[model samples]
Target: MTFSIVGRSDDGKAVGVAVASKFLGVGAAVPAALADVGAVATQSYANLAYRPQALALLGTGVSASAALAGLIAADDGPVSHRQAGIVGMTGPGATFTGADCHDWAGGAAGDGYAAQGNMLAGPSVIAGMEQTWLGSSGALPYRLLAALRAGDQAGGDRRGRQSAALLVVSPGRGYGGTSDVWVDLRVDDHVDPVAELGRLLTMHSLYFESPEPSSLIALTGPVAEEVRALLAAAGFGGEELEEELASWAGVENLEMRVVKGSIDPLVLTHLRAAG
Candidate 1:
């Protein structure tokens, strides 16, 4: 009832999982990752314990294959009904499909990624994911999302789509650089969950990601005056323009794009729209 990709960034700095399924709240169950460690997607009679167990092994410097082996060894239930994909920060990816999993259930692994599914429409689902993961170019989150979308387009879980999720982790990439969860977006219930997940990713980038250096506009001249006017109109007027803008940004959740001497075009656009 699920399809997923677990992968590490080509630079070895990030790891994540993207999953979609007919199951409600698939994000809460199938995907797990740790910065600089590895990612796991446990489904098809998923043993939730496999998530932490796999991460623990990879955190200890074991390869993905070894971690998977350990998981199978430690399982007490019907391992034949389980399916999993694991990718460590530094090693070849690994995957497993139990003999008794639903039809069309299987997985594939390459140097830095694994693609897997169960109760899929056909082999095309996994094939599409593997092809996309290898061919797509971008940050880890984008690449993982592309693979998931490909799988969805090729025919994901035969049952249908209800939920989807994307999770990526990297060192100090979280909000305020205080954690490792760089991106965690979920569509708990949607008719088109994969596309909804993509929309959320775009929103995440706007609110959480920092602006590119080239995209910064100096907060002087006309731009600064415009911002000041917008802030005042929004009832954030204060003696100091920077302080007032900061206050407005806090309220708008655009603090991540706020700079000391310049403003992200997105921040300005958002302020203008809000005003």
Candidate 2:
């Protein structure tokens, strides 16, 4: 009935999931992630509670295997009809697919990822999804996207493709670092859901990614104004922003914060001038 990929970012500071289903609003039911506890994907006769309960266990130092046991033990559902995957905060991952999950439902778990699917077109479909994911050598977001595409190419849901979603977050990469969601986009019923997701991700990178302090670049002339324009266009502003920008106008190679909807005057000035 569903398909999903759950994993931590390469840097290990973030955890996220991408999932889709013929079912409506698959994002609301299949994906869940805690800033520190990892992620969960519970499908089939979907158990929404497993999302939070599993995270709660992972929160208390539970390994992915233990957290899964606790969740399964709590559920009375017969194993044949249930399917799920979990990536624990410790970074190890785990997943399970019941005997009765439609035609070709199954999964693979690894050091940093959990992949699962049910009601697939066939066994080969799941295999292709797994192969592409394993063979992928790219960013977490890209790998997850490729896995989804492989599944679709393999036959996808016998019912057809309707919606898809992508979400990735790092320790402080989220908005201002607290209660922030780094990437949260969904396509409920698009003709090209995956392609649309890729587009959104590209936009996200442009607006949110900031240069690391260690790689600070010296700026002069129109560079400062360009940087400010970029930041402003991305919607970052605040009372103290001007002060930070002023400092950057004089200092070269100073690291600047580029938070959306927040002020980081130094980065703002650099960005504005760079443009």
Top candidate when judged by TM-score against the true structure: 1
C-alpha root-mean-square deviation, each candidate: 1.1, 6.1
What are the per-residue Cα lDDT tens digits for candidate 1 across 72-163?
99999999999999999887899999999999899999999999999999999999999998888779999999999999999999999999
10-114 per-residue lDDT for model 2 (tens digits)? 667678888877776777788888787788888999888999998899989978888988888889767678888888656668898888888777888888788
Q: How does residue 209 of candidate 2 score in lDDT?
A: 55
Pick by lDDT: which candidate is best? Answer: 1
Give Cα distance to truth, residue 26, candidate 2, Å: 0.7
Counting clashing residue pairs in each candidate, in order, gives: 0, 25
